[model samples]
Target: MVTTTGVLFIVAAVVLFFFWIYGIVSFYFDLRYRFLPAVREHLRDDEQQARPDPEEYL
Candidate 1:
């Protein structure tokens, strides 16, 4: 009842679906580990700005 092309297409689709799922999982982890820390650091404003020496301008 099944054709060779149909089986091949089903296998290809399943492999592609798994790859898509893996990509989504990896992207989620990347944001959780790397992006969140960067966002927190950017939000914190406790550091003082550096003042240039007046003699340098003269």
Candidate 2:
């Protein structure tokens, strides 16, 4: 005999597994394609380096 609660649990687990996979893939793509480029551009900017290092104040 199939219990309704057991079926519901299985369905929920499958849905959550898909969500976990989607999160991982999206994060990986965002980091590789978007986040890294932005970071590189920011770091390479001359204006940032021209500013006095905040650590010097310490």
Candidate 3:
């Protein structure tokens, strides 16, 4: 019984590890392919619109 339990625990651990690795990899690829460009474009637009003009401030 103890051996069976140990084996089951190990199997569960490995399965969870695989899923964790898969999630991390998928997240990274999704961010790189789908999200980064949009984020960068948003930031660029915000920066362009938010620039401070000294004359305006004066």
Candidate 4:
């Protein structure tokens, strides 16, 4: 027979597991949709700016 404390512990474990899954999914989507694009754009812009003037470097 399950006691009240056991039931509470099981419930808390289930709740925390659900929250952990939720956080992982949220972070995955956020990084895929928003953060990566912004970073790629910044890197592309920096690469363009870093090219030396043809007259100065050649």
Candidate 5:
């Protein structure tokens, strides 16, 4: 019974680790392919525009 439990725990740990890795990798590729260019463009626009005063937003 103890051996079985240990094996189950190990399997679960490995599966969870793989899932975490997969999520990080997926997010990186998705951002690189889908969102990075838009983000860069927005940043460039912000830099080109005059800096806004923080009080203006309030």
Candidate 6:
């Protein structure tokens, strides 16, 4: 006694939920593996450049 619209809605909900989970897992791994390293590298470069010379009148 189920309608076609109900079945379609259920299917769509399941598909969307799977996609949501996939996005979360992908984002976590990407941020951990790629983003953190890149950010660290960028920060290191910043630290290496434009540094003030040490005061000689200490």
* Model 3: residue 57 alpha-carbon error in angstroms: 23
TM-scores, one per candidate: 0.72, 0.66, 0.65, 0.76, 0.63, 0.65
Off by over 4 Å in 4: 52-58
Tens-digit lDDT track of model 4 for 1-58: 9999999999999999999999999999999999999999999999999998799877
Instruction: List where candidate 3 sits over 4 angstroms from the true fold.
Output: 43-58
Cα lDDT tens digits, model 1, 1-58, are: 9999999999999999999999999999999999988887766633322555678899
For all candidates in order, the CA lDDT equals 0.85, 0.95, 0.95, 0.98, 0.93, 0.94
Least well predicted 10-residue stretch by lDDT in candidate 6: 49-58
lDDT: worst 10-residue window of model 4: 49-58
Which segments of candidate 1 are over 4 A away from where they belong? Answer: 46-58
Where does model 6 exceed 4 Å of error? 48-58
Task: Summarize candidate 3's per-residue lDDT along 1-58 as a digit string, tens digits.
Answer: 4698899999999999999999999999999989999999999999988998778977
Off by over 4 Å in 5: 41-58
Relative to the true structure, candidate 4 reaches a TM of 0.76
Tens-digit lDDT string for candidate 2 (1-58): 8999999999999999999999999999999999999989988886788899989999
The C-alpha local distance difference test score for the whole of candidate 5 amounts to 0.93
Candidates 1 and 2, the one with greater TM-score: 1
Q: Model 5: per-residue lDDT, tens digit, 1-58?
A: 5698899999999999999999999999999988999899999998868778788899
Candidate 2 segments whose C-alpha is farther than 4 A from its true place = 47-58
- TM-score head-to-head 3 vs 4, winner: 4
In the range 1-58, model 6's lDDT, one tens digit per residue, is 9999999999999999999999999999999999999999999989977686578456
The alpha-carbon lDDT assigned to residue 31 of candidate 1 equals 98
For candidate 4, what is the lDDT? 0.98
Task: Give the range of the ten consecutive residues with the poorest summed lDDT in model 2.
Answer: 42-51
- Between prediction 1 and prediction 4, the one with superior TM-score is 4
Q: Model 3 residue 43 lDDT?
A: 97
